[model samples]
Target: MYVLEGDKSAASRELLSRFTAPYYLLHGTDGKLGTGIRLLDCGDMMITMDVPTDFEKSLLRGKPAAVHP
Candidate 1:
């Protein structure tokens, strides 16, 4: 499985953009936790694991993700 580990400060949009592909961005919607993040799609399919947060349930927000597109 592809894992993105390291300090958030070290992670940048440019670096993440490199993963974009001509087709679908597979292995995306897998699993994640911690602070939320954003996702940019090139009409690709993203896979994410179910991680409904308690905060979201009470706050009426969406499921939290390491990234969100």
Candidate 2:
């Protein structure tokens, strides 16, 4: 797992503020390693969380697959 060095909490707050949509900060995930915090873009809005690798994979799995000819 890649760890981003520096003040992640402040950086995360700044990132979240850029979006116009409402969001809930999952503070529990702050400062946790391996479970990197992320800003999820949901087209109309967004979400922020710090989930384990398996949960992260599950989130990706929920997305629709692209088709290639």
Candidate 3:
């Protein structure tokens, strides 16, 4: 898996946007204890965002990612 880790900065956004294909931005929903990170898998690249607060969550709020078993 291609993991790209960074904060939500201009550089991060520019790097994340390099993937031209479709992807999903995954985040925690409060029920499950996670790493407090946001992930996006665009087939080739896996993007991750560190979101550990309510403000951060609100800032990154967008479409939900569907995880299958």
Candidate 4:
């Protein structure tokens, strides 16, 4: 998970810390919102806590395979 906040909330920081997967805090010359949007636009997939359990399940399933010629 890549967070786009200049400052994270205490609860969000705690939650992210508990995750074994790598989480990044993005800051760029483009600014936080622009950076986040760019990441989302370029990213293969994105998951949010709207359904925490389901998101966890998807994460546990791991990254998808890439096909090559």
Top-scoring candidate (lDDT): 4
**Ranking 2 against 4 by lDDT, winner:** 4
User: Compared with the true structure, what per-residue lDDT tens digits does model 1 show for residues 1-69?
Assistant: 132323222223333446566643535333344322333233232432232323234333554334323
Q: What is the per-residue lDDT of model 4 for residues 2-69, given as tens digits with 9 covering 90 to 100?
A: 44333333443454566453564322222145554555578832532211223333444784322111
- Using all chains and alpha carbons, the TM-scores for the candidates as numbered come to 0.24, 0.22, 0.27, 0.37
Clashing residue pairs found in predicted model 1: 29-47, 29-48, 30-47, 37-66, 37-67, 37-68, 38-67, 38-68, 39-68
Q: How close is candidate 3 to the true structure, as a TM-score?
A: 0.27
For lDDT, candidate 1 versus 2, the one ahead is 1
Model 4 spans > 4 angstroms off: 22-31, 48-69
Report the C-alpha lDDT of model 3 over 1-69, residue by residue, as the tens digit.
122233345443444456444455433223222322222323332443432223334355763422222
Off by over 4 Å in 1: 23-26, 29-69
Positional deviation of residue 15's Cα in model 1 after best superposition, in angstroms: 0.4
> Using TM-score as the measure, which candidate wins?
4
By lDDT, rank the candidates, best first.
4, 3, 1, 2
Against the true structure, candidate 4 has what lDDT? Answer: 0.38
